[model samples]
Target: MNYFTRVLKYGIDYSYFGLLNILFNILYAIFSALAFVSFIPMLDVLFKQTEIVYTKPEYTGIGNIREYLESYFNYYLSNQLETDVSSTLIIVVGIVVFFFLMKNIFNYLALYNITFVKNGLLKNLRENLYSKVLNMPISYFLNKKKGDLMSRITADILEIQTSYLSILELMVREPLTILFTLIVMFTISPRLTLFVTLFIPISGFIISIIGKKLRKDSKEVQQQQSNFLSIIDETISGQKVIKSFLSESFFLDKFKSINSLLFKFSNKVINRKNLAGPFSEFMGILVIGVLLWFGGKMVLISETISGTTFIVFMGLAYNILTPAKNLSKSFYSIKKGNAAAERVFEIIEYNNDRVDQKRDVELIKFENKITFENIEFNYGDSKILDKISFTINKGESVALVGSSGSGKTTIANILNGFFNPKSGNLLIDNNNISQITKESLYKNISIVTQESILFNDSILNNIKIGNLDTKKEDVINAAKEANAHEFIEQQLDGYNTMIGDYGNKLSGGQKQRLTIARAMLKSPSILILDEATSSLDSKSEKKIQDAINKLMQGKTSLIIAHKFSTIKKCDKIILIDKGKIIAQGTHEELINSNSSYKNMNELQI
Candidate 1:
């Protein structure tokens, strides 16, 4: 109930449909009551209770109107030449038709208003959730499971929109209608109403017992479903690896086991949830039978309630039980929605680890020095970098040479502000990096990593993502500079040729060159290249290095050197070992002065 109440507040202020919805539902209840009340006259006609036993009319103002109408009707009936059965039959038929029409029209309008409220809130809620995901800090995504996050964005929010919204509307409207119907039943016979109320607690207890198992099973089903989706995503993305390793049957077995578990849990949840409907209706019919027997005996002995009155009272009692049975269903749906809402809110409520100050430093350009002072970082208990320090002048190229796991990529990540050092500080032109806004910091740096990220878009559009407003000629120029223009022009559509997901349609070298072209378009003050040419052949590497040399002109660059030729061209080379700088000098100077650099250089050759 707390979750339902909280979620409603999110929509109530955002749209006026909440107000409209409540108004129409109330109108629906009123008209439904009036429709049933119209039966009183019909029952009187059938039971011969419409004789003129007149009393004086006394009223004031608009309150006098009903008495006036009643007196007029009685006067007309009394003066009629004949009181015939055929005329009464026609009158009863007219009353039934009129009441049925009123009931349906009001019901239609109530359902219509609900459609507007549900779709409007759903639109706004999805938009807000998407905006929150995009604006949250990068660190927030690192600790989350992609499949569970996907479930929140796709399945859980949709459950809130579908089941939760429907249940909420029913919880409000049906209960009010039930209450009004109960009041009418009491007016007809208080003894019968009391007898009905005695079964209320018993029906509620049964519903509660059945629904108690629903939430736990619902949670389990949701978890298994997410795991299944994750496995599918993994298999699709790594299809080549799976095929190469010949583990298709192994993965299939794993998937089948997970699917079986999901099926079992889903059966449990639905079985428990679905019991509320028929079981509740059965109990309701039982109560109605009990009422009939007791009320029939009372009617035989009592003069106040005729058989016709008793029959109409029974109809109203059945109407009350209809909504009561529906109430049990709505409660079950709310419990299911509670499980979904918990997962959805978990993602939207996670605390982003990166904090921004009230105000941040803004630098239009880089001028002085970029310094890493005694930096340390750990991913949980495993330290990735330790007490590392380095500096780069405004317009110089510095390369870091190391084997795998020697912290080359980590340094590149730290420089691009993708990660924050756990200890010590980084400075740009003497101002602390933490003081700068992420947008401003990113404006001064560009990265081209080993994996070339490209969307499924035209080559022209892909490069233009570096700067959306970049002109066509500008894209071609950047492409030429990366040595991608010659190959791209050879394609059938030239720059307009579509690159598939992750640029799968292109070769490794071609994708890397396109990535380099994207970075070239940014024209950043600092460029960080993390083994960007590692996937290319020597021929492609040479072409890319030539492009890199041209691109690094007048820009401070940190190259995570994979090629011996590229390392020798840097103004200085730093040898890193175990997250620390063990040697620093020219390629020739290091080779002369440091054993580690000589060994690495010799190994590369």
Candidate 2:
């Protein structure tokens, strides 16, 4: 109830719809009880020795029940026609019509209201989950599996909507049906009603014991499903790499191993769930058999309860067991759905970890200089950057170069405000960057990393992602400036050509050029280009360098270059080693005075 209540509170704002649904369900239960009670009158008509006579039932609210039904009974069979039109025939026809109408009407209302509830709940859940994802710190993603997160967003939420919430509806509706039918049974014979109440508790206790294993098995099955999805995602995203290495059999073996675990857990869940239905039904039938023998003896021996009343009570009592079966089944479904609900709530409840301080201020535009003062950063036990201090004046180009693990990319990440230093401070225009909004800082800084992130969209749309409002003419100009215009225009659709997934339709140099076009379109005040030309051929690098020179005309730039030729033109070069800045100077000064730089250059030459 607590989980459903919490989900409901966030699911819809108004409570009136839930109240309305309850009211209709009550109406449905009332009609359902009357449909069963009509069987008593039917038996009288069938077993009549003379014209069937009736008096109001001596029970609370029985007067009203009689008034609503007696007139229809009289008109249906006139006194003269008692030989042909017995009360049994009339009652049977009346019960069929009443239940048919109630069934159709209730089914419609139930479906209509649940549609609203399902879609509304899904909408709110998705909105909240996506918002939480956006607000979470970048570090949170590093620890999570991408496929698992994706599965939570897609499959887990859908499971809650379909399995859990749907079972909750049965939790209410079916119990009411069973309760109303039991009340009618009590009215006909208190002894038989007591007989029914006896077996329900025993059967429920047994069913609950069997249901205990459901949650554990369901959780294991869900985990196995997520593992299968992760392997599929990896295989699809890395298809080219797998093909190059010819590892299809390798991936298939891994998938099969996970699939086998899923199959084992699924069997456990199904067995536990399937046991509830048949075991409850068998127990109910056994109790019904005992009631028939005991009650038939009391009636035959001229007990207070008549034969007709006892038989009608038996029919109503049998009706109660149907809903009891439904209730047991719903309980099993709840246990299974709870596993998915736990996974969904786990994601929604995750801590964002990074919190904005009260003293934080919004940044506008950088004016003076960007400074990193004695900054230290570590990822777990390994220091990525240590005691790093540097200053970049307005409109200056700085290059950082070293071997693979030399803290070069870490510096770019820090400056772009992706990661805050573990100790020390980063100041932009003399104001501490930590005190400003990350989004605001990003507005002034543009980055072109080694991985070219292009969506499956038109070339025009991909470039327009830089500045959503940029004009088409401006995109063409930016593309030309990035030296991508010639290849772009040669396409069948020119700027409208579909790039495909990750720009798969294009070559590496073409993708890089498009990425550069995007950065140029952004035209930010500060730019960071990490290995912008390293992956390209010498001819492409020379052409892209011409584009880079034009882009850096009046903007401050941080260049992370592997090639000596690209590094030679920087206003200054900072040599980083083992997270520390061990050398800093122009290329010429470093080549002359620094042994490390001369040796690195000699190796490159």
Candidate 3:
């Protein structure tokens, strides 16, 4: 469906609250019009033009209710005046005050009910947006900017709340207020009401022109804001590299350019939105000016309407201006909100081709072996893995050794079910891995990557994330096994020591050990180490390598190693070159038989 239709559908989902709002708003509008209409009799009293009446007014049909109301007021005023003229004036003033008070009370209730629907829709929209982002495939985010996604969730949703959700108030309350006011105006004088209606279309046509331009500019403003946010995110993430290269000016210039565009587009949208209020007011005054001339002539020359009724009609006409201005502004806001809704829905409705299909089988347990049968994988059009086949039997530690781009890491990714191969089957225990639910598949496996991914939390908390139910003793034991217990104990708070973002507070070796400690806590049946110790110094490497050995004991392991020293003692080594396996053997066997393996081993040495 179109974006506007989608926005209305979101409102329809919460129609219960909207309907309540409508009921209150209708009451508010009727009271509001009656409050202004109450002034008609007060005007008659002030002018000493109260009509003389001896008997109660007779009942009349709806068409003559205005005449009936006027006659009844005259009948009461005549009685009150005979006793005390001051008391008659007091009663008229009291009636006017009561109508005004009731009008405001109903107005407040309309706003109260509208607030619930507004906030409820916003809460649902944000939750759904975040859930969709979490469940989307990893590949879907390969090209997406973190800031763009963040903008969609945060700023874009806020825009929809202000522009779209607030439309409900304008749609129900404002239009009904105008309608009620016009009914009173028509009752007072239909000729004057007819004259006012003729000029409304003209004002609407002008407002529509401004709104058309506002929508186009509003979409650009939102897009530019997303771009600006992306730049800020990239700058913050790569601050180290930017500072090291002394390229701060370059990024500053880029930010300034995006910010400048945002400023210009925003100015256009605001200018257009602001114009609606003043322009509608001006058009309203023009109509009122014409009415004053024509209606005043009718009162004085033709004597078709009274002075007090004409004054009340004028009050109602001016009252219509406020809702008219609001209606015009609401139109502009809906246009802007429609743009934001499109961006939000784009992510919420994203088709993640990589999401696992429904699997009714019980949770998978890794038993025999993981086999890659003729695996062929491509990224875009570039072949990353081609017709490759291998197997790692249960409790065996096999290292995948290859050049930088020879598909070693791709094997780890596919095996971990992060991506599916273009043409292949990764079988776990003779059962297709694709048939296993991702949660079930991942429960039996753990991965430690080259970079340590840690949150800004305590050391104990980070480790506990692997298994929330793990005991303190078990966590300490896991840390001891990973060789991290020593350094952790040295910290002021020991296990409770706060690790900063990405574990930046710790040394590379300390961070790697903690990650190993985390994985050790998981104690999975299978483990994948993707150059887990590649960035560590020799001393740290030896410590982490010892931990790796301890963690790999009696577990099925896949090691993608760049350093020959790291995987030299594996049960077997599969040497890959340019997406295809060229050889598989022990280190000595490969050194004796394969030139490529010998050359890589020599280069590392």
Q: Number of the top candidate by TM-score?
A: 3
List, residue by residue over 26-46, the lDDT tens digit for candidate 2. Answer: 767767777766665556556
Where does model 3 exceed 4 Å of error? 1-17, 60-66, 353-355, 358-363, 492-494
Model 1, range 527-574, lDDT digits (tens) per residue? Answer: 998888878888988898888887888899999976777768788898
Q: lDDT per model, in order?
A: 0.80, 0.80, 0.88
State which candidate has the highest lDDT: 3
lDDT of 1: 0.80
> Which is better, 2 or 3, measured by lDDT?
3
Question: What would you estimate as the lDDT of candidate 2?
Answer: 0.80
Q: C-alpha displacement of 399 in model 2, angstroms?
A: 1.6
**C-alpha RMSD of each candidate structure in angstroms:** 2.8, 3.2, 2.3
Candidate 1: 10-residue stretch with minimal lDDT: 73-82
Ranking by TM-score: 3, 1, 2
Candidates in order, TM-scores: namely 0.92, 0.90, 0.94
Could you tell me the lDDT of residue 486 within candidate 3?
Answer: 95
- Residue 418, candidate 3: how far off, in angstroms? 1.6
